[model samples]
Target: MPMTVGALRETAKGERRVALTPETARKLVARGLAVIFEHDAGREAGFPDATYVAAGATPADAADVAARADLLLCVQLPPADRLTALRAGTAIVGQLRPNAAHDRLEALGERGVTAFSLELLPRTTRAQAMDVLSSQAAVAGYRAMLIAAEAAPMFFPMLTTAAGTIRPAKVLVIGAGVAGLQAIATARRLGAQIEGYDVRPETREQIESLGARFLDLGVSASGSGGYARELSAEEQAAQQAALGERLRVFDVVVTTAAVPGRPAPKILTAAMLEGMKPGALIVDLAAESGGNCVATVPGQRVNVGGVTVLGPLDLAAGAPLHASEMYARNLLNFAGLLVRDGGLSPDFADDLVAATCVNRVGEKQPQLI
Candidate 1:
């Protein structure tokens, strides 16, 4: 019998993106695997049930899909209560943030369900096709700039009107990762004067290529796996002092610096907020992971001394259609490693498979291979 793969409707509140798209489902079916999804799972993302049916996917009840499938795919982790419906030894793949819910992970492990967390995918060229983090970050970054532009008092572009000439907004994006680069590009497209900064000096060229000036903070924290190393206390203080002076001059500030499983570094302080212009705007992309700004409140916007600070949560979720498409493709590519010709089995020796396996069936502890 062929291996069965299926997806359930995401149950997380306000989460609109579906785990599987009809386009990706068709590819899996072509590979000789049966594809199943909960009815109306893709409706919020604009793909109706008819679309999945046309693409060779069966739309069924959520429980039936969970009970029948050998490998379950998801966008958000399924609720803990729902795991009891899964058959023993069923494999699951998703972001599955281990840090957020150890109890749930333990429960799934004890149930003998194998879990794969894509967030742990190594930063290697070979893994680029399956990089959900970068794909979602691009969407978040692009939307963050628009969010900043809307909240700012001044216009993003310069205007030459009867009222003399209006100056363009001065924008600064901290962190030169995929999201930061997209933010810089979007801001530039909006005619803002953009400047980008990162602790990695190697990013200077990338920032320059995007037509944004790169700020030299005289500090480098380049680390393994394409992430900036955590700065020492002295280094953090020095960086804060130097950045505070420059930050005050920008009309819009967007901070995207973050490390996986770690609290975001505090870059903007309360004193710095008081120093900025009266109507300056700040968007903290690291808000969910404890924020890079002192005034950021995870999912709320607050005014600190006349300056507006926005800490957006799940910005990618706001762009449902494209985000779902990108994320679905990423999951499909990763799933390819485990499903071959029609059977569900993984080559434990493959680095990608080994690195992503959080918990296998019957294991007492997670194998951080």
Candidate 2:
């Protein structure tokens, strides 16, 4: 018998992105796996039950899908109560944030459910297609730039009008990762004068390619695996001093700087907020990771003095349609590793499989953050 894969409607609050879309379901069904999803699972993301049915996927009751699934796919790990509903020895794949889900992960381990957390996947050229983090970050970045544009008191594009000549908003995006690059590109498309900054000096070309100038603070925190290393205290102090002076000229600032498994570094201090022009806008995409700005409150928009500061959470969820499509494709590529030819034959020796598997059936393992 072929392995059965299933996805449930995401129940997390403010989460609208579905794990499996009909397009991906069709691909998986063609791969010889039985695709099952709860009815209305993709409705929130614009895929109705009829679409999945047309794609050769069966719409089953949530409980039935959970009971019969040999492999379960998800966006976020289900809550503790929902985890208890899953059968033992069922393999699950998702961005199971083990770092923040100690209790829930413990439940899965106790139930002897095999769990794979994609956040632990190795960063390599071969693993790019299966990179959920990068794929979602791109969506978040693109959306954040739009959020900044919406909140800005001034226009994004320069205009020569009959009334007056209006200049474009001067925008700065900090962090040159996938999110930052996407933000720069989006900002450029919106006709903003953009500048991109990152602790990794190597991102200058990327920022420039997006039609944005690279802001250099003369501090480099380049690290392995394409992530920036934590800056030393002295280095941070120097960078902040330079940034404080340079940032005052921008009409908008978007901070996307974050270190995986760590609290976001404070890139914009309260004192720095005072220097920005009145009515200036700030979007902190790292808000969920404790924010790169002093005034950021995750999921809130507030005024720090006269400047508008927004800390929007789950921007990818805000753009659910394409985000779900990209994320579903990411999950589909990852599923390819486990389902070889037409059967579940995951090789434990494969580095991608070994690194991402959080726990094996019947055994608890030390999970990384």
Q: Write model 1 residue lDDT over 85-187, tens digit each, in one string.
A: 8887788998888777667877787787778888889899999999999999999999999999998999999999998999999999999999999999999
Worst 10 residues of 2 by lDDT: 360-369
lDDT of each: 0.90, 0.89
Candidate 1: the clashing residue pairs are: none
Each candidate's root-mean-square deviation in Å?
1.6, 1.5
lDDT of 2 by residue, 141-177 (tens): 9999999998899999999999999999999999999
Kindly provide the TM-score of model 1 when superposed on the true structure, using C-alpha atoms: 0.97
TM-score of each: 0.97, 0.97
> For model 2, which pairs clash?
none
Top lDDT model? 1
Question: Model 2, clash count?
Answer: 0
- CA deviation > 4 Å runs, candidate 1: 361-369
